[model samples]
Target: MDFERTNPIERDAYKNFDDSSELQSDIRFDQVETRLLRQQQDDEYLQCLREDQEREQRKTQKLLDIEKLLANLCLDEEEHQKKKEEFVKMKEPMLLAIEEELSKLCLEKHERDRQKEQLDKMRKEKAPRIPVEPPAGLPELAHLAIRLPNGERIMRRFRHTDKLKDVFDFIFCYPNAPDWFDISVPLPRRDLHCEGSTVSLLEAGLVGKHALIPKRLRLTTDTTALTLRTTPSEEGLDNRRDAC
Candidate 1:
């Protein structure tokens, strides 16, 4: 039997081929590990970017909300101011009218006060005056007879120093005396009814000069005769004169 002989070169060549195959397999394993690590890093980066974008969107939305609230407050303030102005305009005329009415009332009150003052003055002027009393210790007295327009005679005593105004006040106090009349002396034809007359009875020749003897005198209205007569025992008969 003949056996085939193995060559050394061929055997070595086979060994080299086996070593190259193992090296190639180790390189492929390294490449796969590197690729896997790189993909994991890329995924982590994408996740971080998404989180930042969401945070920025939330911040922007908060700013927009604050701006909207500020705008609403501004609108409310403007509307309140407008309403206040409208209310003032509506009440202005009413306020003016009230002022005018108060002014008119004040004027009316003043006018009423003036009218009341005038009426009081007129009443005071029309009122009767009081008679002044005669002084004491006179030496003479006049027995005067006053005759009214209705033919009524009244007797009274008067002092020599009494003014004619006293006689006029006495007549005014009478119940049935006329409101307006004139007194006059008949023999001399002298009027004695002057307003505010200050002539005394002695000065008008109506008082007796002697004591304890009264002079007789007649005081008459417009329709009666006024006369002065004294007793014969009285002195100074020619000195008795009419002073009216």
Candidate 2:
């Protein structure tokens, strides 16, 4: 007690000292603090792991979409190939068919042309021949008024007119028949005659057909023996030859 009185720090410490109170009160252990800090670090690590997992899922989805697109492209390419093959198959047959049709037409045309030529030759060979002169000379006065190629009126006369209609039945002769003309048919766009045009009888006998004149006829209408004739087309007038 005397020593405590002499030391002021010991007196204050003795005055607060309580023998009944406990020494440990609300104190945290170092091991427990270290464990809590470690738990906090683990929680941070789990959060980072979750974020990484979500990012990976998004990336995987993108890859799946790309794969699907690639698969569709492949399918489209296959379909295109199939369609192209089908088109070629269809086109080939059509082309062959068209070629066959063209060949058939060509062959048919050639055969028809050949037949036409043969028929034309037969008609020419079987056609009856005409004579350019009259038989006994009743009256020989024939004249031809022609519209020239230059659109001019040119007159020509043949001495005699022959009615060889008894020889050839198929003849288109109208008006005055010429001695050198037996058939006078107008060609299209050819104006060789007009209304009231006097075509000589002698020239009408020779018509469009080629004929050989047996002899020339003298005009007995006016006591004048002027050999005047009318012919529509004189294309075959020089075909006259002496008939024995």
Candidate 3:
């Protein structure tokens, strides 16, 4: 028929060839898609493995830090216990020494109390002796200069007939006299007792130029009361004493 017009067989062959080419192309496209999918899966698997490795490393580092903290806490607790033990050891001897000192003080106090009781008993048993009155012929007034232990002189004018208690009262009542003192004279060196002596100053030999040493006596008792008595020796009274 016509060269440009297709024959049925030729047309049919051409159609078959086109169909085969399309089929081959479709097969190749499918194979390329499958390969791309497999490669994507492999990349996903590699990323997951990298992430797991990082997580494992972080966990191991945290565990190491926790172990270090625990070790430090253990060391601090041990040091605190050691210091407490040392303090206890040092305190023991100090406590023992304080107890011993208190015991010694108690014993000494007991001894002092015993001695005080004996002196009190003796003072209570003995009756104070009555003192002699001033002699009948003595002058009415006597000018006396009494020197003290501190090198100070007390100038006084007194009645010869005045009681020895009056002279002592004047001395104790003096502004310069201490709260507690004992009166004595040198040469005879007699301690004047200040209790209940009714003797005159002239009879007690406290008149004229006499150095009446007022000795500062330590208080043996709690009482602030003063006790004085003149010596009973007539020769001691008769001696004229010089300035101290």
TM-scores, one per candidate: 0.30, 0.26, 0.36
Error of 2 at 112 (Å): 2.5
RMSD of each: 67.8, 60.9, 58.5
lDDT of 2 by residue, 50-106 (tens): 979998998799678656644544347688677657657766886898799899989
Give the whole-model CA lDDT for all candidates, comma-separated. 0.51, 0.39, 0.54
lDDT pick, better of 1 and 3? 3
User: Over 4 Å off in model 1, which ranges?
Assistant: 1-138, 208-244
* Model 1 per-residue lDDT tens digits across residues 1-244: 1213557777777779989998996576445434443453466568668879998998799678656644544347688677556656756875897799899989867765664454344334433543444444545776555555443556667787777656655664555553334464432335564343468877766664211111123233322122122111112212211211
RMSD of 1: 67.8
* lDDT score at residue 210, model 2, on the 0-100 scale: 25
Residues 161-212 of candidate 3 have per-residue lDDT tens digits of 7766665555554544542456766534577766644678778776654445
lDDT of 1: 0.51
Q: What is the lDDT of residue 101 in candidate 2?
A: 86
